[model samples]
Target: MKNTYIPITMEVEKNYFETSDRMIKTLRLKFLDERFDFEPGQFCEFSILGKGEAPFGIASSPFDKAGLEFSINRAGVVTKAIHELRIGEKVGIRGPLGNYYPVKEMEGYNVVVIGGGFAFTTLRSLIEYMLNPERRGKYKSIKVIYGARNPGLLLYKDLLENWEKRDDIGTYFTIDTKVEGWNKMVGFVPTITEEVAPSPENCYAIVCGPPIMIKFTLPVLLKLGFPKDKIVTSLERRMKCGIGKCGRCNLGEFYVCNDGPVFNFEQLEKLPKEV
Candidate 1:
C-alpha cells in the first residue's frame, strides 16, 4: 500500500476537558474527513516541540470523520505537557501508525474486548468499526469489561453511558477500590473479569490495560479457554517518536513505537516476557 500522509499543517488537534480526574484528560480532536484512512487500534504520536512527544491511540471511530479523539492520562512528561495545552495551540503529530485491530478477520465471530481507562482507547476504535451501520453484521456479540482506579476515573462517561444503553454490545465496569457514588462492580480488573468470563469458543478476546492488570487477566482468559493467538492486545509503552528510530521503547527485537503498539497475545508470548 502507498504511504498516506497528513501534512503537519493539517494534523488533527482539538480541545477536551477532564470531565473528571479519576481516569485521564480528554482530547477533543479532528480526523479530517471520512477520507482520512486509519484502521481501528492504530495510534499517532502527539508532540509539543519543547516538552516532547507521546503516543496515543486515535480513539474516536473512523465512522465519525468530523473529528478524531485521544483519551490521554496525565502521566509523565509528554502527557503532562499535553494535558496543559490550550485549545488551538498547535501540537505536532505524524501517523495513524502500526497495525490496527483486525475487524475483517473477525467477521462472523463472537467478540469480547477488555479495556481499562486510557488503554480502552483502541477498543473504542474496534467497537466503532464494528458498530458502524454499514458494518454491523461483520461480527457477532461484542462485550466490553472496562474499569479504572475509582468512580471518578472512568474515561468517556458520555460515550460509555451511550454504549451501555446499546443493544448491540454488552458492557460492564469495575474499579480497583469502591466509590461512594458508584453503582457497578467493585474489585481488581482480573477479579471481576474472571467472574464475567465471556466464552472463548467461537470468540476472540482483546485486552489492553495497566501491565499488572494484564499480568493477571491473561491467565484468567487462558483458563476460560480463549486461544492464545485469538487473545489480542495493544501493548503500551513510553513512546517519543511515532516512527521506529527511537530506542527508548523496545522489548528485545520489538520496538513498541514501530513494529507494534498492537500485538496479539500469541505474538507477545514469543517476545521478551516483559512486554
Candidate 2:
C-alpha cells in the first residue's frame, strides 16, 4: 500500500478564543495545488513536528474555501502546546481523512441536528452546509438543538445568535443551569430534545456530544419514532493514525478512523457497546 501522507505545510491564518481555555484556529492548506477539499464530518491529522499529531474534525463547511478550522480544548499536553502557537506559525496537515456524513442521501428529508459542548464542531459544518444558499433547498426543514454547560462555554456564539434569528431554520439553544438575564431554554440537552419532540416523520437526526448526553438522547430519539438507521452520530476516539492500521480506535473490529467517525445508529447497534 502507498503511504497516505501529505507533506502539506499550512499556516495558522487566524485564531479566536472560544473560551478562556479553548481556542479555534483556521489553517490554510494546499492540496492538489489548490485549497484542501473535504466533506463535513471528516477529520485531518494535525502535526506540529516535535509536539505530536492529533485528529480533529473539519469544523468548516466543505463549501467554505477560506481555510480549515479546528476546535481545540486546553486539556492535554499536545493541545496545550497547540494552544500556545501564534498566527502565521506553520503546521502539518495529513488528511481530509475518514468517512463523511451522508449529506447527499439526506436530500428531501428534514434534518434534526442535536449537539452539546465542544463536540458540536462537525455538526457546525453540517449545519452550514445545509444552510448554504446553493444547497439549502435540497432538504425540507432543519431543526437545531444545541447546549453547553453554561452560556460562557458555548462555542460559535456569534453564529448561533444569527441562526436563531433566521426563519429558514428552527434553532434551539440551552444552557445546563439558569443564570441572571438568560432567556433561552435552560436544561439538559436530552430533556429539551424530548420536550421539543421534533417529529421523526421523513426526518434524519444527527447527534454528537459527551457520552452521557448521547446515552440519554438516543432513547428519546427512538421513543419519538426515529429509526436507528435514520439517526447518526460521530464517535470521539483517540485515533493516533488517521488510517485503521493503528489498532487503537477500534469498536468491535471496526476502526473508527477507517470505518467511521460518522455512523448511523443502526451501524452502531451492530458494534460493541464500548465505542
Candidate 3:
C-alpha cells in the first residue's frame, strides 16, 4: 500500500485568482511522477514545504490530463503561503484522499447540483465528469443551482459562461442581493433552490456549501420530496492528517478523510448534528 503520510512532489502549472477580491485562488499542479488518480468529491493535502499543509477538494475533472486543480481560500497560514506561490513553484500533494461522489450509482438518474461559495470545488468536478463527451450519456438531465454572496464572488466565471451556452445542462446563477448590472436571479441559495424546485423523481441531489446554507437548503430539498438517501452533501472539517489518524474530522464513528467527505442525508442523520 502507498504510505499515507508521505507527499508526492508536483509543480505548479497555473495559478490565478478565482474572484475579484483575490481571497480565493485556483492552482493547477502538474504531477512530477506517476499521477495519483482521483474522482469527484475527493480531496488532497497540499503542502508548501515548511509552511504546513491543508486539505482541499480536487476541483479538476478526472479526464483532465493537464493537472490537478485546487481552489483555495486565503484563510490562514498554509493557504496564505499557497496564495504567494507563483507558476512553476514546486509543492507537495499527499493524496486524492477521501471518498468520492457516487457517479456510478447516479447513472441513468437526473442530477441536481446545488452549491454556494467555495464549496463548489468538488461540485465542479462532478459536473465536469458528467458533462464529458464520453460520460454524458450515462446520466440523464443535469441541473445546477449555484449562488454566491455577489456576482463577483462566484468561481469559474469563464466556465460558468460556457456552461450557460450549452443546452445539455440547465444552469442557474444567483446572488444574495441584486446589483445594478446583474441580470440573473437575485436571492439566497435556499430561496433560489426553492424557486427552481427540481423534481425528485428518478433523480439525486448533491449539495455543498457553508454549514448555514446547507442547514436551510436541506429542508427545501426534502419539501420538494427528495428522499434522505437520495440527497447528498460533502462536509468540511478541521482535518490535520489527511489519512484520518488525527481524529479531528470524525463524525460519530466515521472519519471525514477516510470514510467520507461525501455522505447522503440518511447517512448524515446517524451522526451528530455537527454537519
Candidate 4:
C-alpha cells in the first residue's frame, strides 16, 4: 500500500549559520515542488546517479511547503556528493519515505528532544513543526537538549537562539569542550540530561544522535520513568534504496525504510543494537 521513490528537483541552498571547527552545517539542498508530504522525522533517498544514493532526514518542517531542505554534515562519500551539489543542480531524489514522528499522539504531554551532533538535522524538523500554531497546542511542553564536540560543532545556532527565547519551549545546549564564550552545561548529553531530570509522567521523549549517545540516554530515560513505548527514536543505518526493497537497512524481520526510521524503544529492542 506504500510507494517508494519520487522525482524531485533542486530549489535552493543556504549558508551555515556560523563557522564550526570539526563540523559544518550546510542548509544544503532545497527540492522544488516536491509535494513530498513528510511529517517530522521522516527521510528521503537522494542520489547523484553513479555516485550512489543515501537516505537523509527531511530537515525542513512540514510547515514549509515551498520546498524541502536537508541540513547535512560533510561525513561520508554520499554526503560529500550531496554537499557538492551546486544550486540549480538536479540530483535524483526518491521519497518523503520513512515513518514520521508522532506529533498528534503527543498532545497534552511534555515532550523532550535529545539530539547529538548531526542528529539535530532530523530533530530540527520536529521542533519547527511543533512550533507552528497549526500544531503548537498539541504538546504541553517542549525541551531540546543538544550537544556536539564544541560550540562550533553545534548546528542551528540561530534556531537555538530563537528556541531559547520562546516561553513555551525549554531549550538547553552543551558542548564537549568549553569555547571562549560558552557557559552552559559541560559534559555528554546523557549526563546533562540526567542533571535536568525531566519528568517522564505523561511525557514523550524523541531521541536521535550517534549510537553511543542513544545508548547512554536510554537507560537514563528508563530510570526517569519513561515507558518503552513513550520513548521513540530514528535509527540510521546503511542504505541505498529509500524503500524496503533494498534489504540493506533491515533488522531481523523489520526494515528501517519500511517499519521505521522512527520507532519506539519496545520495537527497537527487537532489532540489533545500533551501537
Predicted model with the maximum TM-score = 3
Lowest summed lDDT across 10 adjacent residues in model 3 is found at 31-40
Lowest-sum lDDT 10-residue window in model 2: 25-34
- Tens digit per residue, CA lDDT, model 2, 1-275: 32567546777876777854445433443333435678899998988888888888888888977678888776677787777778778878777889988999999999999999999999999999999999999999899999998887888888999998999999889999999978999999999999999999999999999999999999999999999999999998888878888798988858999989999999898887676
Off by over 4 Å in 2: 1-3, 20-34
Tell how far residue 133 is off in model 1, in angstroms: 1.0
lDDT of each: 0.78, 0.86, 0.93, 0.81
By lDDT, rank the candidates, best first: 3, 2, 4, 1
How would you encode candidate 4's per-residue C-alpha lDDT over 1-275 as one tens digit per residue?
33455546664466453345634546456656545577898887777767877778888888887677777767787777766666666776677788889887898899999999878777999999999998888888899999988877777788898888889999889888677889887889999899989999899999999988999999999999999999999978777676778798888778878888899999878776542
For candidate 1, lDDT tens digit of each residue in 1-275? Answer: 53433324233366565446523676765533233568898888777778876678988787776666787877788888877877766666667777888778888999988887667888888887888988888888988899888766777777788888999999888888886878888988888889998998899888888888899999999999998889888877876666677688888778887888778887888898666
Lowest summed lDDT window (length 10), candidate 1: 2-11
Query: lDDT value for candidate 1?
Result: 0.78
The runs of at least 3 residues in candidate 3 whose Cα sits more than 4 Å from the true structure, single-residue gaps closed, are none
lDDT of 3 at 274: 66
Better of 1 and 2 by TM-score: 2
Q: Whole-model lDDT, candidate 2?
A: 0.86
lDDT at residue 131 of model 4 (Cα atoms): 90
> Cα RMSD (Å) per model?
2.7, 2.0, 0.9, 2.1
User: Total backbone clashes of model 3?
Assistant: 0
